[model samples]
Target: MAMGKTPGSSDDEGDSAGFAEINITPLTDVMLVLLIIFMVTSTVITQQGPGGGTKTGLKVNLPKGGSADVTARTTDISVAVLADGRFVLAGNVVAEAELKQAFDKAKEQNPDTVVIVQADEGVSHGTVVQVMELAKQAGLGQLAIGVREGN
Candidate 1:
């Protein structure tokens, strides 16, 4: 089982057997690297929005009704994610491919904009993530997930 030594290679008589040793150090190293990477990413993604390094120029609609009313701050920009994964920027429906350009323009205009992510109940989580990435790329700082008051 030692390196540079093969039991069967010596005796071509075809009746020799050699055991192999499995080293797990490489696997362990890879796993540790992955863990460290995830840990760093976790720390980096602890928050969302403009002050959070993500653009907030969306004025998406919120799901109707809740335990109470959510006070809409005049200073915040609302970005809504529809059930079909469309982005609503500033009370307007922004095309999927056009989102980045729109966000870029918004970012150029206002760097302190606050973003509100209002996802429809039926929308997939992936859709939200895509929009969030776009927001981050736009260099926004304050990001908010608009949640209605719980009953």
Candidate 2:
């Protein structure tokens, strides 16, 4: 045996100690699993809430016989669609062209506020959708369509 040499190795051998390497396979697998879980959960959360509760904010007549009964929060921004095709925002009548501006102002005032869409029974579905779309364009992600309780 020579100096700094293993007993089982021949004299012609060099440095027998190999380089140390870290095995990150397990870490990478765990990270990928966690990423998948987060992606699925995020999609579910963005689609809808648990019970799909809706809040009302105006005198508009809502359709009856809904399973859910929800009340409006005081801080919520109200956008009302009247039967005459006019839009009422926060108790004041606003023109269709100003709808997005109104919603944007409301959102700026309360960033955490949700938009409550109160559409009368006689209002067209397209009008309601337009209001909701304007609210979305104003950066208001949270919204609820109003519905009245049935007898």
Candidate 3:
């Protein structure tokens, strides 16, 4: 008896069989989901800083200066001296002793971190100098005084 040719069979002399092509749709979908997850988490992380301190946006009337303007870095630590002589660090009211600890922690994390003292116009010069000295003792070299632009 003669063997008959089968449809889609490798034995067929004139026919060729090959593996099916791979489908990447599922892989693409998984990658897109992961990307979206990372984007959402990163936004939440930036909203809350390392110590969970958000900018208090404290109102302080900065002293005016005529010197050349310099753009402040976002990484710079802000030490706000209110007109009432209260020290606000990282948006929280901090005592003089706590100020030094905060500066030390910041310097330990980044040795080049700059301390920017934003003292109100009514704040005493001595208070501002006190914060600067504390920052200097914390091993931080860069220090800046926040001032308003224009005269």
Q: Which residue pairs of candidate 3 clash? A: none
Question: Which tens-of-lDDT digit does each residue in 1-151 have in candidate 2?
Answer: 2455544454565544443356999999999999999999976654433221132223677677575544556667767688998987655678977778767776887887677777888999899888888888889888877666777
- TM-scores of the models, in the given order? 0.49, 0.55, 0.61
Native-to-model Cα distance after best TM-score fit, residue 147 in candidate 3, in Å: 0.7
Off by over 4 Å in 3: 1-55
lDDT of 1 by residue, 1-151 (tens): 3345566576545544565567899999999999999998765554333332323344334555555343445445566787778777654677866777766766887786666678877778898788778878889766667665554
Which prediction has more favorable TM-score, 2 or 3?
Answer: 3
Query: What's model 1's overall lDDT?
Result: 0.65
Off by over 4 Å in 2: 1-58, 65-70
Candidate 3 versus truth, CA RMSD in Å, comes to 7.6
Give RMSD to native, each candidate. Answer: 14.6, 13.6, 7.6
Q: In model 2, where is the ten-residue run with the lowest total lDDT?
A: 48-57
What's the candidate order when arranged by decreasing TM-score?
3, 2, 1
CA lDDT scores, all candidates in order: 0.65, 0.70, 0.77
Highest TM-score model number? 3
